[model samples]
Target: MGRFIALMILVIPAVIAGYGIKLMRDTIFTLLNTPYPNLSVQFIAGFILFLAGLGFIGGFIFHRDKKNGKIAPRFKRRK
Candidate 1:
């Protein structure tokens, strides 16, 4: 189905991004000899994930619905 394909396309990038961020965080923590991640780093990483999810998931879902004409136009004037 188109929805499944769209979901996969959107999800793959976010998953890759999440994995890449985790790898980077681990590398930095190891190099810096930090036992725990900084709060700011944690917040930034979470924010990035949030944005990725919002953008991709929201975009695909909206696109699919719009493609099917499920979304109605707003603010139409009465005839």
Candidate 2:
């Protein structure tokens, strides 16, 4: 059950990241999404979404690693 929950958390962010990529790609090809008024807005929103999702995933992994003592000495929490 714990593993499933963890997987679910990871999957949601991955889907967000994928959608962000799609948005950026569509904007580049001049296929504007109706929700966004212009290419620039679409691209910017995509960029934010991509970074946010990626950051959340990265942070999750980093926290797990730190908890498992797999992080480098420089990154380990000060005792």
Candidate 3:
């Protein structure tokens, strides 16, 4: 049950980010003939989603690995 919820949390943002990338790609191709290609909110939203999703996944990995001692603590000073 917990794992399912965790997977859902990771997947939802990834799906949103993927949709955003598709929207931006289509917008760019459709506007390729225009003299001045302008960016729409969809592009910005997609970028944000992509970054947020990456961050979430990275953090989850770090947390999980740290628990198993496979990775060092993020804030600990290595001497």
Candidate 4:
């Protein structure tokens, strides 16, 4: 049961990560086609999304245990 839960947790985010990658790919392509000087705000937003997507996907792969198959997110310290 624990293994099953772990697998499910991993799979759900894996699917979401796949979607994020696709969405970023398409958005980047679109942005490239647009005129220069896309709003700084726009660039910032895109960069944040791109970074976050990569982090989640990368962390997921790195944290996965092939035996039990769980994806664990890094712990955050709140001040």
Say which candidate scores most in TM-score: 2
* Ten residues in sequence with the least summed lDDT for candidate 3: 30-39
lDDT of 3 at 38: 55
RMSD of each: 6.5, 0.8, 5.0, 7.9
Per-residue CA lDDT of model 4 for 1-79, tens digit only, reads: 9989868866776665565455556566665324324544445555565566667766766655533545344433246
- Give TM-scores for every candidate, taking all chains together and pairing residue i with residue i: 0.51, 0.96, 0.66, 0.40
Off by over 4 Å in 3: 31-38, 72-79
Q: For candidate 4, what is the lDDT?
A: 0.57
**On residues 1-79, what C-alpha lDDT tens digit does candidate 1 reach at each position?**
9979867898786785675476457555644324436645654565576567667777777777877777767623347
Candidates' C-alpha lDDT: 0.64, 0.93, 0.70, 0.57
Mind giving the per-residue lDDT tens digits that candidate 2 earns over 31-65?
99889999999999999999989999999999999
TM-score of 2: 0.96
Lowest-lDDT window of 10 residues in candidate 1?
27-36
Residue pair clashes in candidate 3: none
In model 2, what is the error at residue 61, expressed in angstroms?
Answer: 0.3
Clashes of each: 0, 0, 0, 0
State the lDDT of candidate 3 residue by residue for 11-65, as single tens digits. Answer: 9877876766766685677543233245576566657767877787888877787
